[model samples]
Target: MSGPFVYVPPVNPVNYPPSPVHYHNSPYLASFYTDPNSPFIPPLSLSGNASPYQSPNTLNSPLPTVLTPNAVPFPASSSGSAFAPENPWNRERRVSWNGSVAAPTVPNSSWLQPPMYHYRRRSDAAAFPFQQPVDWTSLSPYAPYRTELVQQSFIHPLLNAEDRRNDLILDMSCPSFAPMRNIGNNQTAPITPEELNQLAFYPQAYGAHIYCELIPDLPIDIRYRPLPGYSPIAPPLKVGDILAAIWNDMQLGISQEMWASLDENRELMISRAYTKRCKIWASRGFPSMRNAGVKKVDCLLGKVFFRGLVPTGDEANTLRMIVA
Candidate 1:
């Protein structure tokens, strides 16, 4: 279904009246020269130009001129005697429509006063209608309110649980936050090195790569490379923990940088080991181990060790030499 449509009318230009004329009271100011009560005496040249005893009726004012047709519509003002030079004969002529209207009249009210069409606003000065006080106790605290409060007294317990859940599941889907297996209060026998060495043999035919070159003195050959598993011990160990263990055992002196390089190659092996471990545990109806995230596993052999080493694909010979 379609939504409702609205039609709006266009507006027209409004008409306004011409502005009232404004008279500058300068004309009467010049008359002060003849009055003795004036604080400023007129200059001699100005006094000489001024006429002595001219009757008000003898004054001849020029016809009011239009300064601006639409905007001002009024002539500038001058002293009553200023017209003397223009009308030297002093004949009082009716320039305005009515002789009595020669001077402009001031309006009783301002032009900006509200128009007659405008309704005057009657303010309600009295206080707002009294409202009865609410009995808040009668209303449940859990009642829904659209307004949010800052530092409100009541906190919803669900909010904390939601925050914890958000921290766990980034995409809000599966049980990503499950704890690691054998990590809780339960205790189990630790894996031994003998078992690890036994498990290191690859039953699936790729195992030959793992044995150390039994003939390191033999010039390195092609096709029989070391099938280096992620680590000497199975079950992914933290690269640091493994290096520390090696240092503690005092078997070989390998630097952290060498270990770092080994881990890079070790990642694929580590992933495979974890996959195998997970399958075994699952088949036994045991809980799966949680991923501790991919860790860097470095090699003990320095780059110098493999300087001229090449692959030699003689499995029977290599296995005999390696097993020896």
Candidate 2:
């Protein structure tokens, strides 16, 4: 009642049209909505007929027919062209532009034929210009042929009939060089069974034999000579002394039979020890066994020591005898 009057504008609410209802008459939707879990349903045609279900894949569609131009047959003969139609089988003959049949330069059969090889005989003068061919017919059967040293070496007059028979038997079984038999005579006696047994047990003696017989008695050149005013830590050793020490050390703890029966590895160890001892002794101003004379003595001693047949006291004497 006490406030001043204020002017107010008229307010009117806007009228809007209602949303239209959507009617889904599509057969696909009708079928789908009928069973949500149903498989795909093709839509009906506008003609009110349910069309047959066709695969959505376009691969099954019938291919469009393509129209091609008709083929024109070739004429039997053409005067303008150089080539003319002929039977495919008749490859050797071709009709020329002038209507004359021409034969091929090369026969058709020759195309598939194998290559031919031509053999040329060398002239005798080109093969052997300086020498004349031997006439085998003119050679006499009784003429003595040049005998080879190897053949001559095999001919031993002392070979008995029994030994020859054994050799023949061995040749039949296993062909090899004839076995060496003892030449029995008053001067040279055959090897005893004991010696054979010893040799069989101590094969290392073969190396001694090789050193004594096969190796030439050439003097070995010394690489290092004894220096003047040089004092050695140990006394100088002879080859015999060095070998004796090695032999003693090899059988120090073991019996003679056990030492002989040592395995290959044990033997190798012993050999290495011997080589070490040699080097050590060489440092003491000793003449090394590398020297030929010393080496020969070493071989002889090696055979004697390994065989264990000679007395230890007589080793030096035996070595001297062998060297002499």
Give lDDT tens digits, candidate 1, residues 1-324: 987976533423211111111212121112111211011111224343365343222245334335422232123324433222343445697765644555654334434333334334336524545644455434432333344554312111111122222111111001121111121223212222222222211121221221234223221111212233323332321212211221222112233564365455564554564455445445544453333222111121221111111224465212211110
Q: Report the lDDT tens digits of candidate 2 across residue range 1-324.
A: 689976543423211111111221212111112110121122323452333343221354433323312222234535422235554235586655885676744423533433444434457558677765655434423333443553111111111121233221101000111112223221222222222222111111111111122113322111112234443232222222212222222222223564476578756655554454456446645435233112222322233222111212332222111121
Every candidate's CA RMSD: 43.8, 47.4
Question: Which candidate has the highest lDDT of all?
Answer: 2
Error of 1 at 146 (Å): 99
TM-score list, all predictions: 0.13, 0.13
Among all windows of ten consecutive residues in candidate 1, which has the lowest summed lDDT?
A: 168-177
- Report lDDT (Cα) of residue 35, candidate 2: 16
Can you tell me which runs of candidate 2 are displaced by over 4 Å? 1-138, 146-324
Q: After superposition, how far is residue 45 of candidate 2 from its true place, in Å?
A: 99
lDDT of 1 at 88: 45
lDDT of 2 at 93: 65
